[model samples]
Target: MAALTGLLFLGAMGTANAADGFQTSVPSAILVDYDTGSILFEKDADKRIAPATLAKVMMADVVFAQLRAGKIALDTPLVVSVNAWRRGGGPSGGAAMFAEVNKPAPVGELLAGALVVSGNDAAITLAEGLGGTESQFAQMMNAQAQAIGMTNSEFHNATGFADAGQVSSARDLATLAAHIIRTFPDYYPIFAKPNIEWNRIKQRNRNVMLDAGIGADGLQVGWLKDVGYHALVSAVQNGQRLVVATLSARSEKERVEETRKLLEWGFQSFRQRQIFAADKEVGRAQVFGGAQSSVGLAARGPVNLLTPRSGGERVSARVVYTGPLRAPVTKGAEVGRLEISRGPVKVLDVPLVTTEDVAVGSLMDRAIDGGLTLMGDSVRDLARRAMAKLHK
Candidate 1:
């Protein structure tokens, strides 16, 4: 009876702590390490959810591709077509840059307006400029999504709005955001725009992190009654970058708080460690026929791992491979493997290879050695048999 009471008290305490740390309003969320792609915390991240304006990340991908290919420039002026303006103009769906039809806006200004103010008109202009139509631009978005290995996402339009079928999972959104951060680093600064200037008009960023008292620098946010609230927030601190994606948040305040809590937990709970330095000499392998009998080998992996930061010793390491390698070893030949473990968990299995070439011995030398070995073994066996017979 006493043990049962203690158990109940422990369970209650655990529940209380979880409640304190976790939010009550957000329906889905994910936090990840931007450098290593480690998921620190997640809740229903794979479940399909509405992307809302967060779909703009895919749109941005297409635009950045054009910039990288030198097909477009930030200062290039794009003419707004009637179709783009009409498609983007709506009530309470997405903010518009109020671009006039047939008028031109700088590519950079449109990008800023899309990111800072979540402008649908700016996105449509970009889509038309890059893909000739919003529908075709969506194809580019989906293709890029597949290219980046986003399995749980599909794009129906260039802008994430209240389309009946436009949707993406939180995990897919996080993957897309990570790709943007890694692939188009230069354009990433646009996400940090607290306010943007276009056609002599200024609009403030809808992302709450700009003033949410956190060190939020880049990313986007969205809200639609059907989709609730969503955001993809990214921040870098102390050289570590973390991306948090929240979906179906009840309110803007909840989205900001939930993002902060998730990021804080990730940075505070884990750390990056160098388990094996790249190309550092790890072991040696014997060469069958070579100038040297053996050559030094080193690990072939990054030699670093992200793990819990709570003061643990260096991982236990062991060499795993068929050693005493036979014959002429080519320099940099992969031969062995290094297995590293922290406690019972294996951190990494790194491939080890020869650091330098080893030439095989001459055929005459190999023949002579084989003959000597065979002769010595035969003589020893015969002598042992003869001695046994004499003793008998």
Candidate 2:
């Protein structure tokens, strides 16, 4: 099937990354606008790596889902097994909330432990309590991951224990972070707080940059000796929030610097621009056997983007849909997408919907539309062949 594509050429592209020459050395990284989910910048974003403690973001997400569903309350008590204590608590000599062995801790405290303190013990306890076993709880995590669109992520344990299967990409991690903040607004404070005390043990937020200012509010960071440091950072400047996921920084300082640099650059280099106003027709999608040959398409809301602040950028716009849609299309039905790209990076993608309903056309109209479609395709093919021959 031929896709309906509209090609557009915009003004001069700016120096946001071109003239400024922004580069990242982190093995895998992605910068995203939280509101629009735009890929502002990416470097090997899909490369999978053992996420270490970064996996806890998903663990917290599963627990949050349980809470949101009323399956568990923040005050619900979960017992810390010896296995959890031995492997994740003080006995393991890793970051832990120091939850006592065999003692029951409240779900809220455990969540605080896991998120604020990066406590493996608290995480395992919640896993065992909610799913009956850490391994089983990992299944719950996987399900939640899929439901919320963390496509390139997997889980093996509640605490980010070293497992070959426990892996995710920078983009997936950023998606997880954005999902958490957006879905669980009430519970999000735990991720930003500087400290949470559990079992008489106080641990500062593992995210070192949380209090370092620059509007760094929430998110998580992780490190494994083998994989270096991985972090998911969310920050806002001037009311625009950006989520950054970076992996394989050689040191904690490097992780903090690389992510912070990206966030600062994102805030400084981009400015919001309105493209299509709400309810305005963006383009038209062809209709087969309809009252009209094509249906007008518009976005439900104003189409806007955080584009380069300086000058016009080289942008390609396309109103893309799979087919000349079937007849009887309803108004406001999602029909296609308005894709805008800056060079190789897709900066904006908004859902395009039918601006008005279209009923089935008469047989004569249908026949003419069919003929036109056939002719269009044939012409396109012939043009491609002719161009190929000319090039040769």
Candidate 3:
């Protein structure tokens, strides 16, 4: 039994190392593989900081949900209130859509203005129209954040206008970006538009990567007095999409340059390696008191890793489970974990599940298995005692 466990450990050690060789000028940043939720690189990714305009992502997400549920329509007209005009419209001296006071605008146009040009007025109008007040809309944002597994984030406003206690992490922002892309495909193209014309004024998107011709697409950009510059840039190359979130850079140029470098490194340095196919047997575990002597273990989905382009074949993996596993075990039950590593650094860990059911053993089989398990425990105890005495 000990030898079998050792072999499982050895088998799991067959994967490449995820190295942290890249450096960035930004204080907080993260790069993720969009398809697999893999963290390619990170620097203080979970450190909560003011999100600036990036908070608009949640604002859009809430509105998008409403649209999807038929609670609102794209052409739903919103009446611009005085609060919206004063706080986010042209009067506040920040990013504004110049929304006319007391004038009605369609929801589609406001969405375009907010997503394309980061218009604060458009954000406020949408929030008030949907939630009856900006404060209520903020509650919706917080509720949505909690539902989406964004554990370390909070929302206080619709426009992300530098309010105290409004904070998010680079990782959380990246998660939001990915969610928007995956959930709202119909509305995502608005992010790619370079500019939106409203009230005779044209404002361009702050995300310059959209025009970089590197398969870049829609996301968000943000800045505040103390938060510096921040942006979430996502692009696809050769069927692979990568999202890079940056925060607290010295300038917009720094954010763009650092993000570009990180994306380039991700594309150039690593390639995806398939460890196991979906539902394919990875290994087997001894099944005590079951009709079958052993049960096959497999992953619920395809297991893939982003490994160094060169020498990626030298990776290792280990299958770890507390055993001998007692049955009856149902199919798809999580029984173990597959830990992939390279040299000394661990890269990925995925759950190992049973591939098929294992029925409870008959009475005679159960008796024999119980006797065997007792003998195994006694031997393991003796081995531990021997090792302890040697150490003494």
Identify the superior model by lDDT, candidate 1 or candidate 2. 2
| Tens-digit lDDT track of model 3 for 1-392 | 44244233333323221243458989998887888766677778889999988888899999999999999999999999999999888899988888899999999899987878888889999999999899999999999998887888999999988778899999889888899999999988878888888889988887787876667888888889977999888999999999989899999899878888888888877777676899988888777878766788888999887766654335567777878788898988998888766566555667889999999976755665775666775553444445446757
Q: Is candidate 2 or candidate 3 better by lDDT?
A: 2
Question: Per-residue alpha-carbon lDDT of model 1 for 1-392, expressed as tens digits?
Answer: 01000000101101011222444357787777777555555667778876889988888888898899999999999988887678774433448877777889889988887888888888989988888888888889888889987888888887787777778887788888888888898998899877876666777888877676556678888988867888898877778888888899888777877777777776676777564477777666544434544578786656555565554344456665564466678877877766654444443455678888777665643443344433543453344445446757
Output the lDDT of residue 144, model 2: 88
Q: Which candidate is the best by lDDT?
A: 2
Off by over 4 Å in 3: 1-20, 283-297, 312-330, 333-353, 358-392
Residue 296 in candidate 2 has what lDDT? 88
- Models 1 onward score TM values of 0.70, 0.90, 0.80
Query: What local lDDT does model 1 show for residue 105?
Result: 88
For model 2 the TM-score comes to: 0.90
What C-alpha root-mean-square deviation, in Å, does candidate 2 show against the real structure? 6.0
Better TM-score candidate (1, 2): 2
Which ten residues in a row are the worst by lDDT in model 3?
A: 9-18
Put the candidates in lDDT order, highest first: 2, 3, 1
Q: Where in model 2 is the C-alpha error above 4 Å? A: 13-20, 367-372, 377-392
